[model samples]
Target: MDHIFRASRQWERIQNRYITEDAAVDLTNLKSDPRNFKLSLWDPTTNGVRYLKTLAYHLGMELSPAELARIRRTPNREIGDPTTVRCGGETLCMDYLQATYEVGFIEREIDLSGARILEIGAGYGRTCHMIMSNHDISGYCIVDLKNTLRLSKAYLRQVLDEPRFKLIDFIEVDSLQDDSLRSERFDLCINIHSMTEMSPETVRAYLDLINETCSAFYVKNPVGKYIDKSLDGYLQGQEAVEMALENGPLRQLLDIHDSQAVQAAVPAFIEGYRPGDAWDCVGDSRALPWSYLWQALYKNPRKPSDG
Candidate 1:
């Protein structure tokens, strides 16, 4: 499986900088320093219980008893001075919670049972694991940087069994150009918190691919100013989505604000900090600020150009 993975030039640069040959997939390594992904709160003392509770309340829902039990069983890491549960082993984390919320939102809006799904930028397969565990999907495709996909595949393989896991097809981001995959259609395509990190060309390329390969698509990204030094200079989430709507063969269906739990769980100073004009307090790192979570759905797919 490792031999099959290949990295694009864009991702190769990122891999050289952050990922190592002996990199182990674990909560500490993932949260501490990573090329493609970053964790907001890494303090050991920061407990996500209140944040999750508030998030569920604000979103007009609650975690079921089963979900709570599962969260408890997942592995956790204690980071700060007085260590607390910040990340769950395989089943619990901010990413896992957000994925669950997104799945619930989508479930209420559409019927995905037996639907063929394509997910771009599947981080560590948190969403993939959750979706497969909860839904009856016909097929699932994961598209991402080879390095990232390697970690995701390893992580998911540990959580999902042989039969259920076999439904997933791991495709490298660069492999999207293959005509066979490009021509294959999916019922839905999803991109979460990754587009903002992509260059304009890359974003447009993905939009074109999604339009060609999917009947509908969902995006969960920030709506305000964001900067990723590795890719585009400045990413205005709203502007990007609008560009896709205007240029691509898709129409906007639904748009909603991101969960407040993201802001609530972080320090108060970070909550008010704006990007460029402000500082990132959590990691004390220089990065873009996320003003709002923009979850949107677009429909009306089109065929790819023969040229």
Candidate 2:
């Protein structure tokens, strides 16, 4: 999968550093605080710590002090310039809180225990860290850019054992005919925030891979292709009215004339269960706070298609 973001100078700089990186690379902001270049993951600067409390309330997640302490542990502390606030006598980053919500959301439907898992485009493996720290999965595989994999591998190794997880670079997954991963199987595959940054062809390629090897899939991304200032060109973007986002930059970008904006998904992203589609929708897509992103769960229990 040729990620569209890989073409950016930001990626190239990070990629070079990964090869010549030293001890300071451990605190590289490429994963956590890339100035204004988020790549796909949100850090404390873009996603402030303020909204996490409200997100918890909306998720209706109840946590005892002990659980909160466990859940809010900041794994990215040594990775970037993490912005932390003292909450409930614990230092927590907003990204960790969001990762916690993501884990909670997934565990609500499926049992992750001993479930072989794959997370494509995992940022710095924050969500992966959250899951592995809390649940004992059979094995976890992360497929991402070499630059990202390097950083995530470093960060994850700090907390995770080498044998428990595997990191595969995107270069290893070439074309639909590639059978390099044919021997592997997973109970679940997940992509968060980054799929929308990929081209339609790349996105479709991942779906094909998921359809082949995984029993279930989860994703949190925007539904439509809207203009974004950062990337200049458009990728799969979020819709305003669809996610019920308030009047803001996203609503402006959709060029809406009414109280709501309606736009169809370009290139036909498989976001939910529709008749004739392979996936069975687990539930309705839930909107993320203050953004056009929505989360959905889908399952395909049939044999991998041979076509």
Candidate 3:
């Protein structure tokens, strides 16, 4: 949280200096700031964190307790601040975006009261923030790597008034390791678009973990095949018509199970359309990245094994 809070501050400064500044002010003035120099030039919306955190990460510097405390006490002035989010250029109310994304994808409104749920890859505790702000799920744990856990804990403290809803639990063993998350289980386990950034091998392990951990789980962004190394900057570009088609690793796995969509995008899977069919799933109608909200559920009836 402290990291995110600090990152948020740095991000706002970036917006103020670069995005909002006029041409008269020398951009060199902006260059002098150590924080700005640290960020690798990726836009704020894409990376989430600002240059400070990246600098600390690269330099292997840890914030002292006093500095951490100061960051923790940093006013939550940006809590309700309006900013344009990455998705659809929507002017999202921070307080409501979390709740709305869940509601939109969950296919139902949430009532977490007395419900125990676990969210994998819970970045910045947005899901926890949304759930807590809206409903009363018993309590959810923000389980991630140690660094993310620490960062998210500080974020919750800064922005959230009652940060009781999220428990900061760091997974010691690798999240992809089978034995790591096997013993723990919950009512609902979720992996939103978060898994998109994971390595291909880890993605399989993540899916396996979710399948084993909870009776019912939600997996959005199930199409992982088109993520090509060459498409790094061009995946969403208009040159796909001329570029040689490549399948991402996830598609191979899904294809074996006959779940892979012949088309690059996933609406084909939902609409039961195949490649080269009379209708195309790739052209003008395609929604890159956010087109289909794949909500797969695992439902296994309880066996008669005596309780």
**Best candidate, TM-score-wise?**
2
Model 2 stretches astray by more than 4 angstroms = 1-79, 161-177, 228-276, 303-307
* TM-score, cand. 2: 0.62
Candidate 1 lDDT, 1-307, residue by residue in tens: 3576687887677556656555545446575455325225433324345655444443223465555543443332111122123322332345555665566545554568787889989988777777777768899999999999998898878777778789999988776563647768887777877875666566667776765677666666644442233233335565764554443122222222334533442332232221122211112211122335545555542422111
Ranking by TM-score: 2, 1, 3
TM-score of each: 0.53, 0.62, 0.49
C-alpha positional error of residue 80 in candidate 3 after TM-score superposition, expressed in Å: 9.2
RMSD of each: 19.0, 16.9, 16.1
Residue range with the least summed lDDT across 10 consecutive positions in model 2: 248-257
Better of 1 and 3 by lDDT: 1
RMSD of 1: 19.0
Candidate 3, number of clashes: 7
